[model samples]
Target: MTKSATKIYILDTNILLHEPFAFLNFEEHDVFIPMTVLEELDAIKDRKKDVSRDARIAIRALEDALVDATPEQIAEGVDMSQYTADHGSTGKLAIYPDHLLNQKNLTLPGPENDNRIINAALHLQREKKPREVVLVTKDINMRLKAKGAGMNKVEDYRTDQLISDIKYLSTGYVEIDGSFWDKVTNCESKTEGRDAVHSVERSLFTQPVFINQYIFDSSHSFAGKVVAHDESKVELADIGYERLMGREAWGISPKNIHQAMALDALLDTSIDLVLLTGPAGSGKTLLALAAALEMIVEKGIYEKIIVTRNTPEIAESIGFLPGTEEEKMAPWLGAINDSLDFLHKHDECRDSSMKYIMEKANIQFKSVNFMRGRSIQNSIVILDECQNMTSSQLKTIITRAGEGTKLICCGNLAQIDSNYLSPLTSGLTYIVERFKDFEGSATIHIAGVMRSKLASFAEKNL
Candidate 1:
C-alpha cells in the first residue's frame, strides 16, 4: 500500500477474530467496518466454537462506540474516541452499508463474504476520492482477490507482530567466541550459599543480555546464568558444565547442552514460566513432560499437572466424541500419551505403570476456552502445540497461574496451523519476546532433533 497523508482502514472479520478490539491499534486513522463483517460476527457470536467469545467482544466494542450516535451520525461517522482519546486517536469510526452495493463487475462477482468485503473496499476506493482506502485482513486469499479486483491498498493486519523474522527471536543463550574468562578483567566473585556468583563489569560484553539468559563458551569449561544486571555491572551465577549435563528430570537426561539449559530453567523453583520452541522432533514435549513429572511427583514442588493446547475448532468436533473431557481429547493429545508410553516402555507392566504415573501425577486435560475465571494453584501447566494460539488466548492461560503454579509453553513455529497467524504474530513468539526481560521467565529453542536420524534429516532438508 502506498503512503497517504490520511487513510481509512476497512476491517475484515478475521482481523477482529485475531484481535477483538483491533480498531484501537490504528492510531488516528479513520476506521470502517463493512456491514457484512458485522453480520458475520453476529452469526458467529452464538455458536459453540471457541472463537464465539471473541466475536461477542468485537460486537460489544462496536456497540460501545456507536451507542449514543444517531443514524445520520453513524452513517457519516461517529467520533469513537471514548476509549482511546488520551492515546492521540483522533479518527472517526463508521460503518459502511455494503448490502446496498450495486457496482457492476464487483470483483469476481459472488455472494461469498470475502468477495463482498473486497467489493466494499473497491466501492470506498471509487467514492472516497484521493484518500486511500486500505483493506486490512488476515486472509491471504482475500487480499489477493482484493488486489486482483483493482483495489489499490490491501494489507495484512500486523499491529501485534513483534518481529519480522523468526530467527530474531531469543534462544535464551549466548555463545562466547573463544574464552569467556579471558574477557573478565575486573570482577567481584563470591559464594552465596551453594551458588558461586560473580559481579562483572557490563562493558565486558558486546551484546545485550537478559535476565535468566544462559552464557556458555566453546572451551567446554564455563556456563553461567545472568541472575541480575544493572547499568554498570552484570551478575552471573556460575553453573558448572558438569552439573548442567548431569542434571536429571524424572528418569530423563539432556541429550545436548540446549536441552540441559532448558532442564535447568524448568527445574528451578524460582522461575515461574518456561517457553520451549523448536522443530517437529526437537524433544520439546518430551523434556517438558519429564520436568512436569519431576516437579509434581518427585520433587513435590507442584501438586498436579494440567495439560492443554489450542486445537482449531475443537469445540464442535469434541461434542460428537464420547466420554469425559480427557477421554474425548485423547486423540488430539496423543503426543502427550506417547511421551508417557515412552517413559515407561521398559516396565514389565507398561500399561499399568502408565496408569499409575497418571494417577500419581494427578494429570488433567483441559481446553483453552475453559481456562478463564479459574485460578490454577500448586500445579505445573504443560501447554503443548500452542503455535496457533493468539496473544489474548495465551494471556488467559498465563494469568490463570495462581500462587505456586508454573506454566510451560511448548511449540514449533514451523508448524503453525492457524491461517490468521504467522511465526511473527504467533502467541508463542509474542510471549518469548515479551518475557525475555522477566526475571521469572526463561525461553529456550532446543537445538537438535532427538527422535531419529531420519527425523533430523527430514527437518533440515524437507
Candidate 2:
C-alpha cells in the first residue's frame, strides 16, 4: 500500500488497558490517541489494578516519547521507533485534540466517551480524506457504534490472537482404528514393566499427531500414549485403561479417556506444562488439584502447590477485599474447596486426614495481581480460570515459573467471562497453540461432562 493509502488506527482506551504497547503494533501506519482517552486514562491511572497500572504505563510512555519534542511535533506525530526497537513496525504516534462534531446530523445514540472517540475518528477521516481511518477497539459495542456512525473501516485488536478459530484447537487425544493395534503388533516390540511397547508406521493416520498425545483404539479396547514420531514410524507406549484408572491420585480416578490423558500428563515429570480446556463440569479443576495433591503430598515431586487465577472482574480491583492475601483469595477459590471436598469424601478421610493433607500438601493461594518479579521453583503452579486472562497477563504468569516447576493451566473456552476476551483470543487458547509443538508441553480438551447427568444435560441443552 502507498503512504497516503496506509491505514491509520485510532486506538480505544480498552485497547491500551488491555495491552499497554498496542500503539507499536501498527507498522508504518499512524496511531492516534484521542485526548478524551488520555483523560479517561488519567482518571484511572492511580487505581490499584491492572488497568490502572497499564494506564500509568501508557501515559509514562507517551510522556517519555514526547520529552524534547515541541507541540508542533506532538501534533504532527512522533516516530515510535525512537522509543522502542522496531518489531516490524514503523508507526508514528500522535495525540489528537478532542474535536466537536455535529452530533445532531450523526446517528450516535448518545454523547458517551465511546461516541466521542468515534466522532474523533470521523473528524480525522474527514481531515485526511482517502487516508483510511480505522477504529481499533476491543469492545464489540464500540465497533458497532463506529459502523453506525458511517465509518467504513473498523477492526478488533488481533495482534495477540494465537488462533483464528476455536475449532482448530487441540483436543489432546485421537482415536486409532482397530487396524492400528494389528499393525503395531506386527512391528518390533519391547517390554517395559507390565506394558508392551511397539513402533508402527506413521502413515496409519491421515494427519500428523503430536508428541505426548494419547491414542485409543475403541474397537480393540486398547489405549496407548505417543512417545516419539518421525517420518517413517511412531513409537507407542501401551497405556491400559485398567492401569490408568486403577492408579488413584488423591482418591480420584479417570472418568473418561480425556481425563485419563490429563492425569497421565499431570503425573509425568517430563512434561512441564499442561493445558486443559473443557466445559464447566468436565473435571478439569478436580483432576488438576488431585494430581497436584498426589504429587506434592504423596509422590514428593514438588515442594508446594501454588494456585492463582485472573480475578473474575474485567476491571478487577482487590483493594475492597479485607484480610490477608489467602483470606482475600478464599472467595474466588470455591472450585478448589469443592475439589478438596470431593477428594476428601472419596478417600473416606476423617477431619484429621484432611488437616494432614492440607498441612502436608503446602498449598498456597497467591494472587495473580502480585505474581510479577518472583521466581517460583520446584512447585506445582495451577492457574485456574485462565480463559479470563489476556495473552499478555498469561505470558507474565508463565514466565515466572522457575526451575523444576510444573505449570498447569485450566479453563473452559466456551465460558469466558472477560468482556475483552473471546475463545479465539483468550490466553488459554494462545498457550495451547503456542506450546502444542513444544517438547515438554501438552494440551488436552475434555469433551465429556462427568459432574452429573443433570449438569451434562444443562451444558448441552440449557
What clash count does candidate 1 reach?
A: 0
lDDT of 2 at 44: 89
TM-score of model number 2:
0.89
Per-residue C-alpha lDDT of model 2 across residues 1-462, encoded as one tens digit per residue: 577978789999998887787888888898999988999999989876677878998888778777878888888888877875446667788888865556674445465888889888888888898898999998898898789888889999988876677887877788876645574534777998987887888887676688877788767467788788899888879888667656668778888778888988999899999999999999999999999998988889899999988887632666578988887887888899888877887455566666777789888888898899999999999999999987779999999999999999999998888777888888888888888767799888888899999999999998
Model 1 TM-score on a 0 to 1 scale:
0.94
* lDDT tens per residue, model 1, 348-420: 9999999999999999998776788999999999999999898898999999999999999999999998766
Worst 10 residues of 1 by lDDT: 80-89
Candidate models: Cα lDDT each? 0.88, 0.84
Query: Estimated TM-score per prediction?
Result: 0.94, 0.89
Top lDDT model: 1
